[model samples]
Target: MNSCPFQRARSPEQKAERRAQILEAAALFFAEQRFAAISLAAIARQSGVTKAALYRYFPSKEALFLALYLSELDAMVEAPLPQEGPAWAAISELLIARPLFCRLTSILHTVLEHNLDESQAREFKQALLACFAQLAARLQRDFALEGDQAIRFLMQVQQSVIGCWAVSQPAPVVASVIKAPPLDVFQVEFGDALRTQLRALQAAL
Candidate 1:
């Protein structure tokens, strides 16, 4: 028999709220900490739920991370994108507003994207593809681009964001250098880099 922790969920809304609470806690932790360094127990504590109850919402830490990523995508989907200089501007604005989201992208390929079973990985990949596809389709409308062009544009956007994130998020010493005079010129802003790439792509196309 399953044991309920704290209190049993009496309604579907309660269940959903509980799940959202866990996800919110996890996302806040990920924003402030490294992906590999965060633990499910920590998330349970932060969410004010028992470890057993946290497991009821997310089977593992990676699953929780996946949920966080999905929430990020949902935010992007909800935004009303205007056509004028929108792609880069919109994405850059998003990264600026949620810098932790950019950090997650930097780790996605190397860390959080791995260490999963085939089935789970497939599920995550499908959701990722869907997000990319939706973004690309919207780009098609905005740029009046072909299907392939839309996808390629999105790929470039991801690469720019990831690369800029890596460059901008340096160690203590490097970060200091990046923020100082002279060296500050070398600081890479993800938003600017993304906008530059889009402009270049527009010129090329």
Candidate 2:
């Protein structure tokens, strides 16, 4: 006699739990290996799912990466600004304290340098500009910065930070150094730089 076996379909909660597990595993794998080099099979193996099952959750590696990218962005934007500081110091602290900060920067650099298609690259650029725009809006509301000048100042600060990250050798070392400088040091130097340039623009306005 032959016996018949039945498998139960997972509930929505169970499916979501499995997807989270896969994402967590993928995040670890991506952190350990280069994003461009890692295969979906490797992610599946690490995630303890078959490739087909992984596909059901994430159609492609790019999709999975995009999900991860957005997650990192959410974390960065949601992090609390420092309660008391000059504007630049507060901004630096917010950037540095995010759990995904270094990885987020690394991923952005990686995407810009390779892997992204033209459309995807355009979308990424838009998202970056949008983030800066939001930051500028927040600054204007909180600190009373004026008009387009405020937005341009925010953009300059963002560009300066990205430029530093891009050319810096030994990425981790540079990330650490930027975070460790004294409050006064950053406020007097970087803050003055932003304020002077922005105030000049504000004066013209």
Best candidate (score: TM-score): 1
RMSD to native for every prediction?
A: 3.7, 8.3
User: What local lDDT does model 1 show for residue 90?
Assistant: 58
Question: Model 2, stretches more than 4 Å misplaced?
Answer: 1-12, 107-134, 147-158, 171-205
Candidate 1 lDDT tens digits, 1-205: 1223567556899888888888888888877787878999888877778889888877788778877877887677566676676455655675567675677777777877776889989999898888889877887787577788777767776777778778767788887767878779878766677667666765565
Q: Between which residue pairs do clashes occur in model 1?
A: none
lDDT of 2 by residue, 1-205 (tens): 1012212228998677667766777778766766677888877776666778778877668767766666666666666665564556666556545434444454555463356578766876677677767777777766676657667766665555454444442446544666655722332233334344444444453
State residue 94's C-alpha deviation in candidate 1, in Å. 3.9
The candidate maximizing lDDT is: 1
